[model samples]
Target: MILVLDFGGQYNQLIARRVRENHVYCEVHPHTMSLDRIREMAPKGIILTGGPNSVYQADSASCSPELFRLGIPVLGICYGSQLMAYLLGGRVETAPTSEYGKTEVTLRSGRSKLFAGVDTKTICWMSHTDYIAAAPDGFQITADTPVCPVAAMENEAENLYAVQFHPEVMHTVQGKVMLKNFVYAICGCAGDWKMDSFVRRTICELREKIGNGRALCALSGGVDSSVAAVLLSKAIGSQLTCVFVDHGLLRKDEGDQVEAVFGPNGPYDVHFVRVNAKDRFYQKLAGVTDPEQKRKIIGEEFIRVFEEEAKKIGAVDYLVQGTIYPDVIESGLGKSAVIKSHHNVGGLPDYVDFKEIVEPLRLLFKDEVRTAGRELGIPDYLVNRQPFPGPGLGIRIIGEVTEEKVRIVQEADAIYREEVAKAGVEGLGQYFAALTNMRSVGVMGDGRTYDYAIALRAVMTSDFMTAESAQLPWEVLQKTTSRIVNEVRGVNRVLYDCTGKPPATIEFE
Candidate 1:
């Protein structure tokens, strides 16, 4: 197993994701983790993540020098590199020119295992102000760039490596190759980690934890929740009860579709209860315009609904949620900025009746959740369904959410999806239509009219962390626009979002 020490970097999870892609299990922990605990975990390798602070700062994050003497392979990145160099008798100071973005680097050591198959000259993503001025004693300068002297350094005999540029980000031309070399070639990991083993181990763990106890699952019927439900069922069949809340924020006809799959007549062998609380949610969300406020209200209402259901079930011991890695990271992680609050994660209320809240898929990414779903033999239609946020279409509609607004956005989204599917647009990661909360003047049937506008968004991404706006076919966009403006009333204009994930998120709100 590889251990990624998070020094409050934004891309900490990305590092773990890359390691898992190499078929090696990895976990991310804060840099404040005790050395004794690190030894207890016995990881095959240790990766120190980048951060925003300089090693010279009075309160900067740092690990013990003994970490290097532990004999385990260690790789430091960006700020991590400066910390390693500073703690181990090396010079670290502000550079004459701070390197940011993609920079050209040249390798000085051809036999370096970290750059085994990498090119002599390559481009890497560099984001740092302080640079390693000098390598520690006995450490070789493996790579360097024009502005940065010690871009990469290593002490082969001690199994310590450091890179001033970020290797986890894709901007690095050969970042994956470098990471693969560190995980496999240098660390000697067998790379036997797979979804099947995760499934077996998680089921056993759930069974052992929830034995003779009643657990209620807040199943949304999305891939994550569906997989969590099935895993719990396989572990303890009747001890699990799934309560699917149809809060009316889902896609058009999604409530009934979810019921058809998990209801009494469905293939699964667990208790299923469907709650139609459309009015309840709409009432709670009435007159709420701020996105975060709407999210927290919806999140608290969901728990309230679940708490009532659990009371009916009598003596429930635990509450299960399908919160995943992206949800947790985007909500906020160890000094990282919060992009938005996921209803299941940051938006949750302060108090709850259950002894504990269980998230079976908490550490898994979106694709990893799908892999576990496939391993459990869930239907292809359910397993491959596009991801839907817990707050559902509430976040899709920008401003105040009303029943009429919900209907307009839902119909527009349905039509947009149908057209995209009909056109067979492959490789589109996620696509949805949102209400813009803006009214425009237009002429329809030779009469002047003012109606709301609908914005269509489509992105292509492997990990949801960073995404590029998909350039949809002109004909497809034109047809979708024409259909939404005509078929969906109250929408006079249709605009395609060309912004990517950095400036804008996948969802509108």
Candidate 2:
């Protein structure tokens, strides 16, 4: 298994995912983890993940000296690379000119394993105040940019390697190629890991872990939970009860798709329970202005309803979730600052009693989950479905959330997705319907009135964590906007979101 030592950077999980995508098993542990424990794990190769802190900081984090002498293949990224060099007696100094954003780095040695099938000049994402001014004793400097001299290095002769820039981010044009070279050429790991093998292994492992014990799962109809449900049902049969809380915030015809794939056509037993409390949710959300408060209310209420229904089925021994790697990283498990917490994170308010939890996809990526879904014969509707926020349509609505508001948003959102599908754009990251607070003047059958403004958002992202605004063809955008404005009632105006995923998240909230 590949070991990814985390320095608390946002891209740590993405690095592990890339390794796994290459058909090799990998585990992520904090730099604070014990060296003895890591040695026991016996990782085939080690990858150092980037972090927020500079190595120059007085109290920044660094790895033990023993980590460098592990005698295994090692790869470092961004701050981790700088740390590797610093720990090994390489000179690191604050750059007179710092490099950030997209920049080109030319390879110094063309006959190396790291540059296999990659272009001589590659576009890489760079962000650092300090850089490696000199290399370690036996390291070869292989790449450089205008800002940083020691941009890349290797000591493959001794199974040690390091790079000053990130190879996991999309801005790096040959990022995947560089990683493929590491996992394949250096690590010599066979590219045999696939969706079928992962599902089969997970099912066997889950069955052994929960032999005859009942497992209860929360279904949100997203790809992650739906795939987890199928995997668990295959392992424990009818012992799994899936509770889907309908807070009236899902997309058009979404509930039906969930029932169709995980319910009837599944290979395992599935007890489907749908709780529709649109009226209660709307009433409770009235006059709420804060987005975080709205998300908390939705989460808290969902838990209340789920536990109540769970009582009818008697005590469950386990709570299974489709929690993926990105969710865990964004949760900031061992990081300094709190980013954001998913519903399943931090546990049940320290009051509600539940048994041990099961998260099958805890170690997998978004693409891996979809692959597993397809392996289990899950239909295209659920397998290729776009991601929706956990807060559901509540976060998408700018003003107070109500049943009528959900209906309007749902209709408008449905129209937007259907039009996109009609345009045959297969791999878009996220598409959402936002109910803006602004009102627009409209004439319905010669009668003048003011109505809600509905905005359509769709973005393309190689990774769901960060994204750029999707540039829908002018014709496609015009068609989507016109259809929403004309066909969807109560939606008088339609607008496209132009902002990317930094200052604004995929969801407005």
Candidate 3:
């Protein structure tokens, strides 16, 4: 296993993801983790992640020099490199010019294990103010850029490596190759980790933890929740009860589709209860427009509904949520600002009835969750289903949500999805239709009409945290717009959203 030591970097999780992609299991812990614990874990390798603070700061994050003496391969990145150099008697000072974004780097040591198959001259992602002015004694300068003298350094005999440029990000042209070399050639990892093994191990752990206890799963029927439900069922079988709440915010016919899979008539052994709280949720969401407020209301209301259901079953030992890594990070992790509240994460109420909350897939990213889902033998359609927020279509509508707005968005979304599938447009990470609050004047069959515009959104992203707008074929957009305007009527025009995740999120609200 590879251990990632986090120094509060934004891309720490991305480091773990890249390691896992090498088919080697990895986990991230804070830099403050005790050395004894690290020794006990005995990871094949250790990675020190980048951070915002300068290593020379009085309170900067650092690790013991003895970490290097442990003999386990260590790879330091950015601030991590600075810390390593500083702690090991190497000079680290403010760069004459701070390197940021993609920078051209030249390899100084062609024999370096870290750059085994990498090009002699390559572009790397650089983001650092402090530069490694000199390599520590016995460490070779492996790579360097114009501004950063010591872009990468390594002590091959000691199995210590440091890179000022970020190899975890995609901007580093051959970053994956560098990481693969480190994990395979340097650390000697077998690269045997697979999702199937994770599935089996997790099921065993879940069974052991919830033995003789009742687990009430908040089965949203999305990929995450579905995988969680099935995993729990495989573990505890009859001890698991899945409660699917139809809070009127789901996509077109989503509630029924969910029921058809997890309900009693379904193949699973767990008890399935479907709560049709459409009007109940609508009543609470009446006149609500603010996106955060809508998310919180829907989130709390979901808990209350589950509480009512749990009470019927006497006592539920645990409440299972499909909260994935993106939900946790975006909802706010440590110093990271909250992008938005995920209903299962930040939007949860202060009080919950269950004895404990269990999130089986909490640490896995979106694509990782899908991999685990496939490993658990979940159906392909469900496994490959587009990601849906827990608050459902509540966040997809811009303003106050009414039954009419829900119907309009749902029908529009269904048509949008249908057209996209019919067009065989692959590589779309997420695509859906949203209801815009704006109403415009237009002539329909010579009659003047003013109505809401349906905004269709499509993005291509590996991780949900960052995404780019998909450049869909003009014909596909035209066909989708034509169908939405003609069929699903709150009565007006259809618009395509061209914004990406930075200026705008995948969802409208």
Q: Tens digit of lDDT per residue, candidate 3, span 1-509?
A: 99999886667778888899999999988888899999999999999998889898898888888999998999999888888999999999999998877799999987988999899999998888889999889899988888889999998899999999989876688999999999999999999998888889999999999989999999999999999999998999888889999998899998889888888788677799999999999999999999999999999999999999999998889999999887876787664457789999999999998889999998788899999988888889999999998999999898898999999999999989998999999999999998989999988899988999888899998877657799999999898888888897765888878887655777776
Write candidate 2's Cα lDDT for 1-509 as tens digits. Answer: 78888888888888888887788877888888787888898777889888878786788888886887878788989888899888888988898899877889899998779878878788888878889999999999999998899889988787777787889878788999999899888888877766688889999999999998888888998989989998998899899999887777777777776666556575446898888877777877899977767876776776677778778888788878778877777667576344555666532344444678789998887888888999987877787777776668888899788778888998888878788889897657888779998997988779997999988888888566667888887887888888888887788888889987654677887
lDDT of 1: 0.92
Candidate 1 wrongly placed segments (more than 4 Å): 95-100
* Candidate 3 TM-score over all chains jointly: 0.91
The true-versus-predicted C-alpha distance at residue 408 of model 2, in Å, is: 2.4
Estimated TM-score for each candidate: 0.95, 0.92, 0.91
lDDT for model 2 comes to 0.81
- Name the regions of candidate 2 deviating beyond 4 angstroms: 260-268, 336-338, 346-348, 439-451, 502-504
Distance from true position, residue 180, model 1, in Å? 0.8
Lowest summed-lDDT stretch of 10 residues in model 2? 345-354
Evaluation by TM-score, superior candidate among 2 and 3: 2
Superposition error at 38 for model 3 (Å): 0.9
lDDT of 1 by residue, 1-509 (tens): 99999887777898899899999999999898899999999999999999888899999888889998888999999988998899999999999999887899999999999999999999998988999999999999999999999999999999999999989877788999999999998999999999899999999999999989999999998888999999999998999999999999989999988888899888888899999999999999989999999999999999999999999989999999999988988898886678889988999999988989999999998889888999999988888888888999999998899999999999999999999999999997789998988998999999998999999999987778767899999999999999988998898999989997665788887
Score candidate 3 by lDDT. 0.89
Alpha-carbon lDDT, every model = 0.92, 0.81, 0.89
How much is 207 displaced in model 3, in angstroms? 1.3
Model 2: residue 203 alpha-carbon error in angstroms: 1.3
Tell me which of candidates 1 and 3 scores higher on lDDT: 1
